[model samples]
Target: MNGQVMKKLLKIAVVAAFSFQSAIVSAKLEMIDRVVALVDSDVVLASELVRRTNSVLQQIKSRNQTAPPLDKLQAQILDRLILESLQMQMAKRVGVRVSDTELDSAITRIAEQNNLSIEQFRKSIEEEGTSWAIFREDIRAEIMVSRARGGSVSRRIKISDKEVDNLLVQIDNEGLSRVQYSLGHILLPLPEGASPEEITKIRDKADKLIRELRNGANFQEYAITYSAGQNALNGGNLGWRNASQLPTLFSGSVKNMKVGDISEPLRSGSGLHILHLIDSKGGFETHSVIQTHVRHILISPNAITDEKAAFDKLKLIRQRIVDGEKFEDLAIEFSDDKGSGSLGGDLKWSDPGTFVPEFTKAMEALAVNEMSEPVKTEFGWHLIEVLGRRNQDQTEEKKRERAYRILHNRKFEEEAQIWLQELKEQAYIKIIDEN
Candidate 1:
C-alpha cells in the first residue's frame, strides 16, 4: 500500500510541472496575437501602437494642451504608419539602403546635440518607455525616405538662365545692394517620428520665438536654450553669401530691408528658419543677356555595353551630323540625356558656369548654327549646337529677382512633398483595416 501511495504522489508532481509549462506557452502565444497591424513584412504590436499614441499625448500635455479625441488620434497614427510603410517599400524599390553604421552615426549626432553621451541618451529614451530598437528603426526609415526622394527629384530639376534673368529683374526693382550676408543659424529639430499635430505645435512655438526676436530678444540666447539645429550654438548665423546665395524665398522678404532685420519664420527641411541679416556689402553693378537655345546629342559609354561599341556609336552619330542631319533631330532620336532630349536637346542659357567644362567649352567655341565634333564629359560624349545668343545689362531689380529664384528652386520640402505623393500614387497600397 505504501508503494502504491509513492507512485500516486510522483504522478501528481509531474502533472503540476506540465501545467506550469503549459501556462508559459499560452502566455507567449497570447502576446504574439496582440499585433494590431501588419505592414508588408513588418508587424505593429498593439502595445507599440498604444505606446506611440501615449507619447504624442504626453507631448501635447507638456505644452498644457488637451489631446485630440481618441478616435482622431488613432486615425492619424494609422495613416502615419501606412505612409512610413510605403516610404520603406519605395526606398527598397529604388535600391536605396541605409547601413547600420549610418544609423549609429545618426543616433550619435542626436545624442551629442542633446548634450548627452550615447549611453546616457539611450538610457533617457528607455526611461521614457521607448526601446533603442524602435528609435533606430525610426531613424533608418527617415534617412531612407530622404535619400530616395532627393534622388528622384534631383533627376528632373534644373536651374535655368531664364529663371536667373527673372530674378535679376526683381533685384533691380528692390534697389537693394547686391550684398552677401554672412549668416548663421541654430536649429532645434523635432523628433523623426513626430506626428503632424506635434509638428504644428512645434511650429507654433517657433513662431513665438520669432515674435520675441522681432521684439528685440537676443538671438543667440534663445538659440542656445531652444534651437534644435547643429548651428544653434553659433546663433544661427549662416556665413558670407551673396544675394544669390540666399534662397529665393527669403531673398525677396529681406530685400529692401536694412541690416539687423530678422525675417519672419520660414519653413525648411528640418524646421523653421528665422533669418537675421548680419551685414551687407557690394550691391555691385550687374549685367543681363538674352539666353541661347542650344541642342545636343549625348553619347554615354556607361550606358553602352562596351567601350569600343560606345566610341563607334558616337562616331557614327558624329558622322551623321557632319553629313548634314539637323543636330536637334538627331538628339531627339538618340541622345541619352532625358531632360533635354524631347525638347530637341535645347539647353536654354544665361550664365557661363552652368554646363560641364567640356560641353561649355564646345559651346563657347562654336558660332550660331555650328555643330561640334564629339566632346566628352564625365557624363559621356556630347555634340553641341548654339541655336542663338543675345546680351543685356544687369540691374538691382534683376539681382533681387535672381535671389528669389534661387530660394524658390532650392525649397527642398516642396520638392520632397511632390515626390512622395507621386510615389504613393504609383505604389500598390491596401490598408487591411479599410478593406
Candidate 2:
C-alpha cells in the first residue's frame, strides 16, 4: 500500500470513530488479523477476508449449492474487498459520507421490505450469528461504495437532452414499452491489441466457463472469480435493462433467450462474453405521476461561509421549525433562495425530476409535514419539508422519464466498465496470498 493511501484511510478511520464515539467498540485483535493484500494505501486484513469468505460460503450453502474451493473463493472475495476499500477511500475524499440518520432510515426500509420490524431484523441477524453493529457497518459500507461509484462514474457520463429526445423517438418507433431483461454477464477480457493466438486462448477460456455454467455452476460466482468485466465484483450484474438499452452485441442473443437462459460465448471487440437472463418483465408496464407539495430553506455557502457553517445554520433552522416556529416565517427570515424566500419557500406542487437529484431524493424520503435534516445539494444546504403529495395522470411525463432512464442506464453501464477498468489498471494493487 502507498503511504499516502494508508494515511488517508487512517484519517478516515479516526474521523469515523470520533463521529460515532459512543458506538465505537474495541474488539480484541486475533493473531491472524494482519494484512493479506495491499490496495494502494489501504490494507485488506486476513480477518476481513475470512469473515467475507465465510459469509459467501453461507450464502452458497443456503442455496443448496456445492461450495467452490475455499482458496478460490477467498481470492475472489479478496479482490472484491480491495475494490471496496478503494471505493471507500474515494468516497471519503469526495465528501460522500453517509450520515447516521440516513443509515438508520435505510435500515428501517430494509426491515420493511422484508416484512419485519427493526427489532425483528436485529434478532434475525443475531440468529444468523452476526451482531447488529457488524450488520450496520456492512450496510454503511455498501452505501458508501454505491455513492462512491456513482460520484466517480456520473461525472464521466454525458446524457444530452437531444439524446433523450432521440431515445424517445426510437421508443416510439419500437413501441411505448418493451421487454426488459435482467442480465448477468461474464467477460473474459483480452489484452489491448492482442495477437490472434491470445484471442484464441481467451475464447477457449470463455468456452470452458460456458460449460461450467451449463453444468450448474453459479454465473455470479464464476463472474467474480474469473470475468474481467466492469461489474465483475458485483457478480457481473448489468441489472434490469430494456432491449434497446442492451449492448448491440448482446441484443441478438438476449432477445432469443427465455427467462433463465444463458447465452453461448459471443465475441465482442472488448472480449469474449456470456450473458444470463435472470428474468424478464414489462412489455407494457403502466406509469403514474406522483407530485410532492414541497418547500425548503436554502443556505448557500459564500466566501465567508463553508459547507459546515451552512449545514450548522440549517440544522438550527430545522430545529426551530421542529420546535413549532413557523417554517414559512423562518424561510422568509433566513433562506438564501431569493425567489423562494419571498414566497415563504413554498415550492408548491411539482412533479418528480423537476428538482435536482439530491433535493428530489431528500423530498421523496420525507413524510408529509416531516422536515428533513440539513441536506446538501449543488446549490448548497437545505432543510426540506413535504407539505403534501398526490398522484395524478402524467402519461407524457412518465413516458419521457422512462425514455431517459433507459438511455441513462445504457450509458452508465458502458461508462462504468471503462471507469472501473481504468481504476484497476492505474491502482497500485498487490495480492500477497497466492491462490
C-alpha lDDT of residue 332 in model 1: 87
Worst 10 residues of 2 by lDDT: 24-33
Q: In candidate 2, what are the lDDT values of residues 106-219, reduced to their tens digit? A: 999999999999999999988877789989999998999888898777787777889878877877786536778899999876555789999889888888888888888898
TM values, all candidates: 0.42, 0.67
TM-score of predicted structure 1 = 0.42
For each candidate in turn, give its C-alpha RMSD to the true structure in angstroms.
15.3, 11.5
Per-candidate local distance difference test = 0.66, 0.81
Model number with the top lDDT: 2
Q: For model 2, what is the error of residue 332's alpha carbon versus the real structure, in angstroms, after optimal superposition?
A: 19
Which residue ranges in model 1 land beyond 4 Å of their true spot? Answer: 1-48, 168-411
lDDT of 1 by residue, 231-266 (tens): 443444557766555555566666655788776777
